[model samples]
Target: MFRTAVGAVGLLAALAAVPPASAESNSDYSVLIISRERLEVATSCEIGVYLNDQLSGRVFQEQSTSFNLPPGPVDVRLRLLPGQMPGCAAGIEDQRSTRLNLQAGQINKYRIAMGHNGLELRRASLGY
Candidate 1:
């Protein structure tokens, strides 16, 4: 009994030394943008996605953009990067942030629209 107790205590101590899961944990996500107006050149525009205020990836008018992240809730924001923002990004506001509760093996999609007034003038979410 004494040896068993000592081994159990030692095992518990080692386990407790491990780091806890972070709330900032997240998972990979696939993003798609469709121009509600009309289909533009594949590489004529730039799209950027930000997770928890950090830049995750960018898309240059791709049909879809995918990114991998750690697992939890993430604030996904899409914006126009560099030369893709001739309509805005200078003064006019153009960006959208979507909150997603993510888990491993889960998928999410975000749709943003580009307008003459701003990037992502509108947003639509499909599927959980």
Candidate 2:
């Protein structure tokens, strides 16, 4: 009887060492849609969109893209297209990032625009 009790305790300990299921299992996700507003500058270059330090999508002028992400803090970045051209601003090597805390089952909208330093993301209205 003592041996059976000890074995049961060992089994419980082993189970406890295992990690729980991923947050994706029982967690909700947020729908993020990023829109690239049409600007007179750099109309020819396709902007690169990064999520969590990874390239997620490429956006064109007046284009919109969507991503479904788990509820948490997300890192978003934008990369300007390489090379210089007329009407396009120089300095395509600078990178900018924004931290967003998203909620589950919520829709988040953003607009990417050309700033003095680089590309920036701003919370936008629904119709924008």
| Candidate 2: residue pairs that collide | none
For candidate 2, the TM-score is: 0.67
Provide the global lDDT of candidate 1 against the true structure.
Answer: 0.56
Error of 1 at 19 (Å): 18
Candidate 2 — which residues are off by over 4 angstroms?
1-27, 83-92
lDDT of 1 by residue, 12-89 (tens): 999999998765333344333333233443335566667788887766544565555445777766665666356534
Which candidate leads the pack in lDDT? 2
- With candidate 2 superimposed using the best TM-score fit, by how many Å does residue 32's alpha carbon deviate from the native? 0.8
Model 1's TM-score against the true structure: 0.48
lDDT of 2 by residue, 14-128 (tens): 9999998866633478989998765633567777789999989988778889999989999999886554545445464666589999998888999887778777887888873
Error of 2 at 46 (Å): 0.5
